[model samples]
Target chain A: MTASGGPAVRLVTGTVLDADGAPVAGASVHLADGPVPLPDIAALTGPDGRFSFPVGADGVYTVACRTADGRGARAAVAVGPAGAPPVELRPG
Target chain B: MTNGPHTAVSNQPVEITAPAAEQAVFEGPSEGAQGGSPAAFTSDGLEQVAGHTRALSESVPAEAWTAPSAPLPDIGEASFGPPDMLETVHGPDDRVQITDTAAYPWRVNASLLITAADNSQWIGTGWFIGPHTLVTAGHVVHIKHSGVPGRDGWVKSIQVMPGRNGTFLPFGAVTSTNFRSVTGWTADGDENFDYGAIVIPTELGAVTGWFGFGSWPDADLLKTSVNISGYPGDQPPGTQWYDGRGVSSVNPLKVFYDIDTAGGQSGSAVYRIHNGGRYGIAVHAYGGLTTNSGTRITKAVFDNLVLWKA
Candidate 1:
């Protein structure tokens, strides 16, 4: 099925960390199509500072993270339409 | 001296007939009696409103309508840092400042206003949704500390300056004839229900050509692009700004986006273009550094909006 016709099965994973390299729990993580404005998937980092997204029709995707104190960071990863391996994100 | 034309006063009162399911949204004393009752208008307030009206009458021609623009850009795959992260002593560049008003005549329908009540003035943004009805954030019109019954914190009055570009008032300013809000916001302080409306004199919207509002499934809405224009406090007060981006996430009650907004932008219309017409789908309210949120126009909210427009 086409990407829009069904739920996204491609998985992207990452870890969120503070400037000190410590896990930043409760930070918001967003995954969107490459450089495009707006994220298609959003989630909060868990206690272990891990987050994941199931994006559809992924070519290149941007992963962004923002902590409660307003610190933010982002990175870009390329994914296949079928799926991709895990990725890590560190927000300064 | 460019105030358009002096049309006779319609003085037509809008009859709010929200359905029973939506009545709970408007619970509380009538809007006029919320905050210590309406305060007596000061001469300065009256004069300001009059000046605003005259200016609008001269500036907004009767047939003023913004022609449609190109469809929003497609969301492509690329990586960019959050706007806040890019900030340095020099300042942030997330918001694209709009300098040409003629290119965005519809911006005239968005207004920045001060809610004067309890001897304090609070600023917020609002947009025209009908010939006389304006939609804005609920908190813009009323403030309640506890959200308790009979604890209404309604403001005395709201002064709206439409098409305010810095010191210039292209369409003019006016005060609300009435105000309305959802009980979830006024009584419960629920962010999910932070929506409200103001009733203005009919002539203003007639000249501005208000936007239509709608409610669509979140899935379908996610596929479209969204744009918002409003007065941001951080910028020069009264100057409108515009930004458009695809929705980041959406739920039944809220639409999330990365569009940069500031405090004064609450109540700005979060709208999209469909079939060459602009339709509001949410009422912009909250601004987080990473994500800005708006109260989604659900079926219940859409029904209430229809009644308010009627």
Candidate 2:
């Protein structure tokens, strides 16, 4: 799916890290749940282990991430219409 | 757009949808609490047509409706199931991505990125059952609860990408506004009735091929392993993921299984293969820690689907 436009589009961004805090790339990241409809599909971490989702409403959304080999982690963060602060995830 | 004598409803609501702009443009959903008229007929009229259609359909074997373009290679037998599948807890993130998405079966599974009535964008999944017909979770086409006031009605639109591999669209994508669901879901938001359908403006399924679905008996379902493959939001974006396990349990309306999945996979096909033929048993919806479930294909649902296929 293509990205939505307009400068007002707020985003919930973060990076997936290992237990030691090193950036973990290629991990799958998802939102546990959010307002009525979340945008697009889940995010896949880039080489820098970062992922982002476009958000519009305010609520607590879980940034759940998992590695190709089964390691995973999740963080629940409060968000606003403007978006949430960047979160850091560490999969064990 | 009006229909012939067989239907009277106008076509689905459209909003300057290009072949594929995705979420680039936003538009309000069809006005009113009532959704846009169904692609075909109203429930009353559909049932009437189904009466005659069902009689003719029953005579034909399920596989004849739509077979794959050619035989498909084994898309994995799964980590759990009969004879010796080592039935165990299904958590290990073992789902494999399908790069051969241009092939049959895989191509039939479409990734659904949806825009609800509230204009909130979300992700889900869908599968082609006919040249133009798609079966999906009711929630994908219509939002429920939502807490978003009057926006809990039909979705605004859907970007259907069949055989999508990450950003690569082997079959491209189509944005559809036409959709179908029962009163149990649209009116009451009943969890037990969370099944729906979509009809694309084009006959994409004809080239992609489609799956046949039927209401199998409980006894048969218990012995079979249901296969699930869809675009889960947690995975690589737009890529299809798969997992399969034996039916954990079943009721008259729901079929429970151990298929591993997360959000964005709400409408994947829960199918069982018999004699190498794939037929959908359910429309995958709810996902849990240990299990995922779907709306089973019952006789009544079968009839409704037959009519909706038009």
List each model's interface RMSD.
14.2, 12.4
Q: Candidate 2 residues A1-92, lDDT tens each?
A: 11111234456778988877889876767765543233223445667887666543455666787676677787877777656899999888
Q: Model 1 residue B23 lDDT?
A: 30
Tens digits of per-residue lDDT for model 1, B1-310: 0111111111135434434443322211111111222212222111111112221222355378332221122221222333222111012334545554322334434654543343333456787776677888776766544212332366567777766776677666788747777666655555566777877765566555566677788677765667777766445545667666566677768887666665467788887765545678899875432456788887677766766665
Kindly report the TM-score of the first chain in candidate 1: 0.74
DockQ of all models, two decimals each: 0.03, 0.11
TM-score of chain B of 1: 0.69
lDDT of 1 at B116: 38
TM-score to native of every candidate shown: 0.55, 0.62
Q: How close is candidate 1 to the true structure, as a TM-score?
A: 0.55
Collision pairs in model 2 = A38-B121
